[model samples]
Target: MRSADRVDLVLRDVALPHLEDGHGGAGAGYRVDVAVHDGRVVAVEASLSLRGVCEYDGHGAALLPGLHDHHLHLLATAAVAGSVDCSDATTLDELGARLRAGTPRAGWVRAVGHHEARVGRLTRDLLDALMGPERATTPVRVRDHSGALWVLNSAALAALGPLPDTPDVERDGSGRVSGRLWRLDHELGARVGRTAPDLAALGAELARLGITGVTDATPDLPRATVDLLDGARRTGALPQRVHLLGAATAAVPETLTVGPAKIHLRDHDLPTVDELAARVTAHHRTGRPVAVHCLGVEALVLTLAALEDAGHVPGDRIEHASVVPPALLPRLRATRVQVVTQPGFLSARGDDLVRDVGAAEQAWLWPWAGLRAAGIPVCGASDAPHGPLSPWQVIAAAADRRTPSGRVVGAGERVPASLALGGYLTHPEAPAGSVRRIVPGAPADLVLLHGPLEAALAGVPANPVRLTVVAGRVVHDAG
Candidate 1:
């Protein structure tokens, strides 16, 4: 289809009603007429004229604000979406079946989703038993994000020789070469797509999922990847706005509301706090916000300290405060920092969290309630490809707070659905726990659900994205 010459389209659905204010205010829905000239939104109206190439349809669906996956690895996630996935393989037998059937190749031989903070240990012997000498010379490896790895057979071990030791395999009764790989899965996933991705393909997929934007967290991933994405956007090869976090380059803007610094406070430290703090301070001095990536306890402190030292306040979002300690909760809340969290993983981890990390930390995992009570800003996130990137699922996970096995680790930590949506960093300066309602003058970024917001969120597991509109363009018509 060619680009429209005049007013491009009008999309409307029965359920695309305006969000109700909840004070006896009537909720209203508008028929969105998107005027596009040169592929950018010129006007969005309840009704408008069409000079050429007009399309009108929302098909009795629902429409709301466009969704965003604030934390994601664009290139890697896109590539992993196609690789041999064993994320469903729950036990040794299942993993073995996958290993035997897939064959001996240097290509990614494994796919795992269960977070390492949950699935604790899988021995090399067990992995070897799974391979059954079929590829004793071939490599066999498995990994999780939280610094644990299990490698089986000589080939796999040799291939992984250069990687750092892992507690799952290397942890001895005392301390020595235990032959295990720590957080090997996460490492492998990060390594999977060192090659450049087709950003055009990724952008298309994002629109399909009701996503109009992304706050890319994988900053040090590869310069080529972001360049491709940025180039694509400039050429209209990609439509979404990319907020790339440049962890290595000096070209990165110090203070940016849309694009900010990507700092990781997690296992396998790389960049120093002083470096991060400098960037935060630079952005703060310029009156802009920076987004950070923090997944572990220690990293969180480093991030907190850097921000405090710089005298920078909380527009600096410490996204994915997944493992913050209770002691730091108040400090995090008291500051101007906000958080973007993925409760779905916590829900998926279930009892394994207790088994691997112990009860206390598991209970403190993704502490949403304490943050909210302390007025700490927080937003819901999917961290897609690792978690489903649907806002409904994110909202439900945050509200329900139940793991895959029906276990609730810190039951009291769940936040309300409304509050969870409020924290999305998709839009600049949007407060935590607030919705981007469709108002007349607002930019036309809308999504439609099949039911009421509350009910739709609760039913996300049963349904997916219904319709997605970005900058007034109906990019996704799920029906």
Candidate 2:
């Protein structure tokens, strides 16, 4: 903790891995002593005799750059973490029991990860019927796998007040409002009470996975949520750095720097070409790059077209370009857009994707190698709550491409463990999706793992993180 000429901290006898090729190849990494002073890596050499206020003997563990998630929904992930997990419920009775057992916030009970085939046709009527009499007044919400649809009970509808005749709110043929919502939970959730997961606890969870920073991709983040995160970060309650991108335009606190403007485009709700172009123009005019959410090929094509017309901006981003056809790769390369995707999705939903997209197109689904070959920079993200949050698990998935069903997806797109890990590195200027190497002059944000890089990446006992330092501050120390 010493300031001035004395080093703040010193990591001794640490091995660093080098990427052989910029595109998924590994090179030999040598052991070095990394010294930090005033939150920046001051020195990295084979040996150093300089003394420091505090020292951690690496014991030949791999010292890698800290992980960064390019696309995350922190608040949503936190909310889901605290909700009743319906992810594994297979029967309607099981789903009902799970919902009934959940602790309600105020008078509402929320559950995520419900599939129609498993839970039967999820409808307001079915939910109300399942509740019967034990929970007639308790509001119930069941969300789907994609987080796009929500089946709400009658109690929830009443609690949220009169539903306007909006396109997002689903209604029956008889003018009766069905308690089904499409991408409008944010509005409905506001009516009910809000229960936020402990930021400190969540930060600790992230630190354990060696995550040092995250780019929150939640659109139109509320001011209250921003204030809550900022306070936690300032007080050291939240140790990870947070970068936010939302639809609302507001002056954020210094703790929360302004990020790109977000435009969400889904398959069901397609925006006209003009509408899309207008949004791109508006964000570009305000000196902000646009981050578009595209999940399907249809959405990807439309988004690419808009970016093509709008021209390339330095920081324009494509969130979850999950399906980029080979034919369209050339168009995407022509733009300065960066693809921030979740390779973990292949592990979580690979079976469904392969089934939907068919075998031929499945090869292009979440293609890391194709993007790299097309001259497009790709960054990895958890898209948490929707996907897994473990950095090591995600990296392994990127390398293995093995799904929960033991099926290999996009075999040709599997990246080397080094390049997969390098996807998280952040650059100073283009901080959004750029990769940085672990060298002197870089911010001293790093993680110390239990073994060599290759062994860790191969999932051999899954290398546990021994220490996590963010901006030179020791956030997590397992030792």
Candidate 3:
């Protein structure tokens, strides 16, 4: 902490960019010199003279803050490993070819996007038809907007035996497991999946995308997962800061310290007002904010009620606040819950979203505007394999409000790309512990995009984020 000793690192002559300015700047964007000491930004300005072993030349490149995946299933995405991709087809016929050609093993057969009009409604009839005699042998699942299920044919059924009443199943006239399932949670046991990428490797992956940190979602924060990350940190492999999150209902783990609890009452439908209120009250008393997984409108309403009853106030992060029914806006306005969403959802599932939910159902898609207009603070996430691991794509989806075909679904809910960056670039909602913007006093968490901001956001055509840096470390170097 000596005055003569500048800091551990400094990023010079860089153009720092921000999604928005808070308070003083009203979304005041930044692009300038950045100085880092130890691990924190010491000062950010146009020019700075500092003595440090390591330095990054901004060269007028666009530097952004760290990106966070506020509400995500990163483990699931990671398990995908970029291999089996069903994200492109507009019809099941196309998917059928892909499936029959080289289906990955036989575990949970899934179709990413199946539009109703194009492919029609997916019922047990389709499952029976697809599986046919093999339904007795192979287990398959198709994932539409409504979720998915394993098509357990007779052999598969005999193997597993009578099914449980989870996911609100749709049965045939004779009243048998239809395989056309709803709510994929109940049928599956307490399945906790995580892709524990090598710490050094993960650091490199995140850095390439310009991410400096991420808040992993979980029921019980995976000790093994964080342990791997911790190991990476010790070995200089871990790339960014991490803010761990555990389910509110979980028994806190000792290995991790200081993080929010993840709440997902919508899928499981537990945590009545009393239960939620009690939990929030207790957690707030602990002096920590709770991040609720409320992607449905009904769930969002109930969440607000719980927060209010618990005597909790603003700054409590609300994840996936996508299903806000118009009526709830005024009420949400009265609270301090920050509305966070996965902007990448629009394009993530490709045609599947439109297929499963139908355009009418997608009328509100990832309602970014509704949240912003209500003055509810909002943030963004890539949602990864479910989407992609890049903020630029989120920005493109947010700004364009359309699909790859140039068709708009939730036009009214779109946010300007600049503003959406707040989630990926500025809002604390994303990159929980990730770096952001190249500014002095801030660790160099930056992205070198191929083009300028406007061009990067011009939809599918532009290539963004050629380089990513975190804390003066070159995670992704397009150069």
Candidate 4:
């Protein structure tokens, strides 16, 4: 390597996807030599004479901008990776067997993905009986995938002790605690603390899949959680850039830089218009964006109304406009709300959605194309433990709208794979309207795939990421 032309890194003979014509056809891209220096692309030419400290032979592989997940609960997803998975248990016996097999940590036996229909109703007495008399004293907790309900044994409830007499706590016909806790995750979590899996290792795993950025959309992020993420990033444990959306109220840190104030709304249980207006107005006054979680038509409508009344601020977002109808498109566009949607929901829970959502609202679920056509900016997300975390799976779902059962949910809303991939490239510097591309002066956050651009966009290949570079540094290299 010659010192006169030295650069940090260079990739020779890489196929660069045409910025606009990505996924157009078999030969939509051209080959170029790219040089990186000081965390940015310094050169891209048909051929380059520069010497690099590290030179990689792309061998004609496609090189593109790195991916991002616009919405995900980082801590929760990491926790799910280590939690006992009961998603496959089809009967009470099976679930009980799994529970019996679980090793309690800190006197708590926790499990996730509990399905009542398949395993029958779970109750305090039922859980106690399942544990058998010898181990009945152990505290046990099991949460369903929906994140709405939790079933706890008597010991578990006692551990938390003398809970507030709130509607979220359930009781049986005999006035005994039913062991079913509703929407009290934050409360329960406070007691359990941060017993999640290794967050640094989880971030590294994401890097391997070419994810260079993510928004941690965990509402009401506690100080401990925030500090944990900050420490990880400082120590280089986290390679992806993180943006955060907090709950209605949270401490805003300078470094973490709170991105939005998250408002969680449920169907028919929404706050009054005046209440919503007040919150939105206050957040705007404080220079924080508002991100509302609206999954049903009713929730979406109410949320849109609130945003309209408050007057849409620049960075305002709608997290999941899950069931947006054509009638609401004009209203939504007028609000100028940016949507962070979960196309991965179709792949993860499409079957249940088909059964639950009425025919009138069927096509409205995950209306990315419709939103895009309405001039509303849309970003794709993997709501993580709630949805699959794989960016490729999310892209496929957006492009195909196909469920695991092979049923297409909303064929009319299907988008070209390239367009879906572009959704992940929206960054603070690039914003919504700005074009995302790989060229000189752009940040060298990129992924090198083992195929041509057209092939990748037709459908993302499993295990396609050969290398991931973030800010000119190779974060993951399986090359």
The TM-score leader among the candidates is 2
**lDDT scores of the candidates, listed in order:** 0.59, 0.80, 0.58, 0.80
TM-score each candidate: 0.76, 0.94, 0.76, 0.92
What lDDT score goes with residue 106 in model 1?
Answer: 40
Q: Tens digits of per-residue lDDT for model 2 on 244-308?
A: 88735565787766567878885787988778988999889888888899999999889888887
Lowest summed-lDDT stretch of 10 residues in model 1? 19-28
TM-score of 4: 0.92
lDDT of 1 by residue, 1-479 (tens): 22333554444333444443311122445445544444344555654555435454555445556766677766656655444566666666666677677643345355445243333456666566667765565565554543234444555656555556433346556754444564344454454434544667777777776676776666454445545665677665456655665444444332212445665443564357788778778877766667777777877888887877786554577778878777887678656777777787766555555565767788777777877677676666667666665656677778788877777778888766655654552364443534565544566666656555555545743555666666555666766
Which runs in model 3 stand beyond 4 Å of their true positions? 1-10, 17-20, 23-37, 42-56, 90-92, 103-203, 218-238, 247-258, 267-272, 348-363, 427-441, 448-463
Q: What is candidate 3's local distance difference test score?
A: 0.58
Per-residue error for 382 in candidate 3, Å, reads 2.5
How far in Å is the alpha carbon of 1 misplaced in model 2?
Answer: 15
Q: What is candidate 3's lDDT per residue for 1-479, written digit by digit as tens?
A: 44467566666665554443431112324556666666566776666666666676756655556665554444444444423444565576765555444353434343443444555566554644655564325544455533333333343344445666654566776878765555443233223121343446555666666666666654454455556545665566666665566633243344223356666564544568898888788778877778887766667878889877876544477777766666777877676676667767776543555655644547666777877777776767765545666666777787776665667767788777766665665534433223344444555555656545555556434445666656556667666
State the lDDT at 208 in candidate 4. 87
Pairwise TM-score winner, candidates 1 and 2 = 2
